[model samples]
Target: MRIRFDNTWIADSEQAILLHEPGHYPVAYLPIEHVEEGVLLPTDRITTHRDLGATRWFTVAGPGRRGERAAWTHTDLPEHASVLAGHVAFAWRAMDGFYEEDERILGHAADNYHRVDIRSSSRHLVVRAAGTTIADTTSPVVLYESGFAPHWYVPRTDVDETALTATQTSTFCPCKGIAGYYSVAGIPDAAWFYRDAFPEAARIDDLVSFEPDKIDVFLDGKQLGVEPGQTVIAHGLDRGLQPDEIAHRDDSGLHNTEGQQ
Candidate 1:
């Protein structure tokens, strides 16, 4: 993984390690040698990773941009986890972004266990929020993603536009493009649709999916229960960063061994 801040390459390495922290999802880590000089300033803040003990924080500065406690390093760890001895991982949301080769890695470093499979379903699907029908369709598209509920995507035509109120809040999925928001009469962000989905997820092009927690979703008259691993966990990196969060850092030359080695 290669990280850039303020347009300056903070670190680039083929040895970057992708870690799955208990509370946090996928996080990218690179060896200290891969980091640029003066980029990481040791900080006072410390955190404890569920598995990795005694994690230390740092202030990563790039050009005029400085992130308080933006990066962390596991200062002490068991011998089995010594591979991360001299490694540092930045907060995906705090840093500008990540990349593999020249392509950007959205959300976080890719997780082998995480995947999205979109399938066409012919079963009758119904969405309701606060006793008001949100959407009903027989041509629903089912998005089966690892660790999430089977999201039933209904065609825009079958949805009742009168019951949906548009909201400005939007989120991005690395698998899907920007997801637009919709609110029901008494619910907040009850539904969401990807107006312009990424090519990989074009199947759900203009279909909308209701949050099962906020609204009731049924398939063929059966109420859909939350899957074993379904969750509403916060994906901070998925929320697009504000312009004020970006800063450039270009200074002393720091070389990297970046290709897949």
Candidate 2:
């Protein structure tokens, strides 16, 4: 997925760019910018590949060099068999083995409830499914701000952990962070996390778990409340609500919710 060029960047750019390295298995390069400008010297050379043909090459200039020397051919290319390792640069990869249309239709009518909450204490907005509660040093345990949907962080000691057990699955979120998993035996995706957390989100360090969107999210046998519509960034320092480009809808089109039925 990703590879680092110990030290190199494209000519004069300040950002350390990661370009898609094409091949059998695509790899990327992250050269130090300063090094590229001062030391990368082009050579009058070109190589061909059996699968993709006409690969280019370059050389680094020595300290006292006027030009360049020493070429290391680019190896490790992508091929049909190479897909197994997936993308190294990608933190996680979906292995559904189907195109967008096929994958989307696989679970088209799946029922799930998505909930988002902004903490009053931290003001950090967390997207989570309704009904799940996190535990920690608080009365009602908090939830972790992890998963595909955001959920606010709640302390762990405040939750009832009797209904959960650790699971083998794991996931990474660039926004929130990596998560450890827990699940209810008969339920799918009722995974809860603990142990690791997003750095600034200390509030949920050891106190969160999620109820499957398909299940009723509850607290100590009590049902957690749900909203009839999508949550909007009503009031905050960020000012206007998010989804800036889209209009708001009432309870129906946004996400589903659960209550004591």
Candidate 3:
């Protein structure tokens, strides 16, 4: 893995540790020795981790840029967490990019436990909003993702195009590229589709999925509803994400599912 910031490579390591915490994405912690010389400048700021102990902050410096308090290390780790003693984790959003070899990793570090599976199904699925039929299909693809309910995606040909209006909203997923939103039947962001998903999620490309809470969705004659606490907030500037970095669409049209399981 490699970290780039300020148009410079700050760190690269082949033995980075991926630390998973509750209710959060995994973080990549690289050995302190792998980081470029003079890139991490110690700061007076300090914080504490519930399990890892006292954390020391640092200002990450590059050729002509500096990210204040963008890197951290556990100074007083518990005996059980001693493996992280000589490592530091850079604030993911603070860095320009994190890469596995030449391919860039978006959203966050790839979680080993997170999985996305796509399966073709012939289940009848229908979507409705404002008393108008938005989509209907029997050839839907079901996407089963870790920690999320199954999402049935329908081909655009089977959807009522007049009911959908492209919206200005966009979201990024590390496992499944970027998702573009659409307003359906006057409901804002009631539907979404991945025009150009990453390799792992290429099967549902250009397929639309409606929001269960904002619209009526039915699968196999059974009405579908949003699972408790299943709403996902879009990643935006507040999370330090910029459009140019994560919203670039791929036009290769490859449906390879060989990466990021």
Question: Candidate 1, residue 103: CA error in Å?
Answer: 1.9
Q: How much lDDT does each candidate structure score?
A: 0.75, 0.34, 0.81
Per-residue lDDT of model 3, residues 93-190, tens digit only:
77777778776777777778988999999899989887878899999999999889999999999999999999999877767777899998889999
Which candidate do you rate higher for lDDT, 1 or 3? 3
Give the alpha carbon lDDT tens digit for every residue of 1-261 in model 1. Answer: 788776678898999877665544676779999999999999887877667899899899988779887888998888878888899988777766677776666655677777889999889998887787878899999998877767889998999889989987777676776788888766889889987576678999888888877789888998886666554355433333332222231112123212210
TM-score for predicted model 2 compared with the true structure: 0.36
In angstroms, how far off is 170's CA in candidate 1? 3.2
Question: After superposition on all CA atoms, how large is the RMSD of candidate 1?
Answer: 6.2
Q: List the lowest-lDDT window of 10 residues for candidate 2.
A: 90-99
lDDT of 3 at 47: 86
Instruction: Please identify which of the two predictions, 1 or 2, would achieve the higher lDDT against the true structure.
Output: 1
Stronger candidate by TM-score (1 vs 3): 3
Q: What is the lDDT, from 0 to 100, of the residue 184 in candidate 1?
A: 77
What shift in Å separates residue 138 of candidate 3 from its native position after superposition? 0.6
